[model samples]
Target: MRSIWNGAISFGLVSIPVKLINATESHSVSFRQIHTEDGGRIRYRKVCELEDREVGQDEIGKAYEDADGSMIPITDEDLARLPVPTARTIEIVAFVPEERVDPLQMGSAYYLAASGAPAAKPYTLLREALGRSNRVAIAKFALRGRERLGMLRVVGDAIAMHGLLWPDEVRAPEVVAPDAGVTVRDQELDLADALMATLGEIDLDDLHDEYREALEEVVAAKAAGETPPQAPEAAPPGKVLDLMAALENSVRVARESRGGETSGPAEEAEVRTLPRRGASSRWTPKETGGKKSTSTTAKKTTAKKTTAKKTAAKEADGRKATEKKPVAKKPTAKKRAAKSAQPAERSAARSTAEKATGAGKSTGERSTGAGKSTARKTASRKRSA
Candidate 1:
């Protein structure tokens, strides 16, 4: 890289000569303003107000306008003569934690290269010190024609410097926050966290300026005398009446894009209705529940019902087949009558035995009498039949 500035870093009594090279570059497409009707370039010219005529670059000089409308011509020689020590040197003020530097004050970044053989030792020393201490060096350096605050830190093996705006140059961020009356719920915060997790981390190096690429394509197509590719129409912005729904949709879309399973919190996220500005109480989730979640629930319910119906139909068919089969029959009447007659004969024998016992007969005599009576009754009945 070409060096933009050459200076020495004043670290206490140690002076390290270094060269400043820009650390970043832009690849955006540039366009020139032209007359729409004639395809002619519309260029701006420097002119003197007093002479009312265009002037050349050499004739133009910068001037500071005072409140009283007086112009004070300030030349480069005048600025060069100013007793600013940082004009040719990067003076180190202090070493501080890198976090102490406000990112909002950061501006253009540049890499510091050791100027010569003698500078190499000190440059490596400062870089190693910064790396070991995990700190950055606060510095003041002159670039262009003005002095600027800078932060020097180690980037890999080399030291890089970032120009910082003076503390006074950064305005206080007043009145930029939401209204004090507005509040956020825990549920909303949870959904927001889930959305963030769903999107996950990304490698910044993998990203590029897509707009620049598209612009280049258009330029290439026009140069080739062919029709340029039509840009896809952007989805129209919708009023976020439901913050929870928006967060859930964001998480779902992120998961789909990553082709991953839904995150735990994202899967468990419930649809909550929050009162939106200018929205009516009638605007509820029930009314607008036809979105993805509601549809998913409906589909699940339908699937369950279909499964249940199939199971019930199978059970009904089983019951009908069971009903068609014959059941076992009861015993015949004659068999039942014979079983009743046997019990009666037992009762008669018991009576006969008891009568014989009452008469003081021996047990052998009772048994003989009961058997004889039962045989006589059976023979008499058989004769009557």
Candidate 2:
């Protein structure tokens, strides 16, 4: 246990410097308030009842009212200014028999040990002296701004301290007491004794909390992707017409359930199969390829290229043949511009061309063009004959 508080135990002139450590812990499961449907944490806000308005933490202050009924505010600074000599010291009040300290007065228990090497001697001395005297040392110390009344006693091989509750803090028994006239029969008492004696003995350490165990089992089933079997509905509790019958029935149940309380699963449940998850199982489609499909695609592409090349060659040959058949060229832009700029220059060029040609090609081709074609056709015919 780690020390939570560093303080000294002052008795007379001797101050045994020691450390305080809690000796007990609660293992009970804790749960927070939450919305049942959405599982959201439920929230609570502080509000002033008189003003009917939400209160901010900073606006709230501690106050006390006296007989005059006037509120007297006490600031945190004011509390800090008050002197508390026992703030870091547990002042020994008195030593009393251990029986005098009632269990009802105990609040929290903690182990107190020596703080350092120098304090070890004093710590041992206190522990040994308390153990030998068979008594507890009562002390008062301030912790977290509140003064606590505690008692020191020897526990096992070390010293332990228990913070006690004030007398008025614990409720009085007189407030709500059970029936005062209830009487017991000697035969009933004997039966009860026999029942208790007949019950099977169970070691406290061997006993298990059924509710906590069942809750854990449910959680385990959920984690394993399976549904936990539902428990059978309990029979309604019958009214106790006879007290003797009830006691006898309870004894019978205690005996029967002691050995047969827990049972094995009635039916096996199938677990859901999750997808495979690993480095080797993870990849993309781009990284996957088949050699056979790639080869077939390459072959088809090559065939298409060959067919296109053949078609292109035939089209180029036909275009060359049509070009060689001859066609007149259109007039150039410079000639048209020159004609527009100088009409005289255009007329002179036209007259010179007409004189040189003597005659122009009319409805059909010129006689020279026709004679040239006819001569070629005749030559071709003679060669064929």
lDDT of 1 by residue, 161-212 (tens): 9999999999887667666788789977988888888888899999999888
Best by lDDT: 1
Q: How does each model score on TM-score?
A: 0.68, 0.53
* Local distance difference test, candidate 1: 0.80
**In model 2, which regions exceed 4 Å deviation?**
32-81, 199-202, 223-225, 251-385
Clashes of each: 0, 0
lDDT of 2 by residue, 1-385 (tens): 7888888999788888988887877665666899999989998889898998999988999887978998889887866566886878999899999899878899888888888899888888888999999899999987766888999988898988899987778888887888689888774565465456546467899886788777777878988999986889999987666555565555555546665342222111112223346745455322222234676679999999999999999999688547735422212322343354346645654453344335443622463354344334443544565
Model 2 clash count equals 0
Error of 2 at 110 (Å): 1.1
Distance (Å) between predicted and true CA of 9, model 1? 0.8
RMSD of each: 11.8, 34.0
lDDT for each candidate structure: 0.80, 0.70
Clashing pairs in 2: none
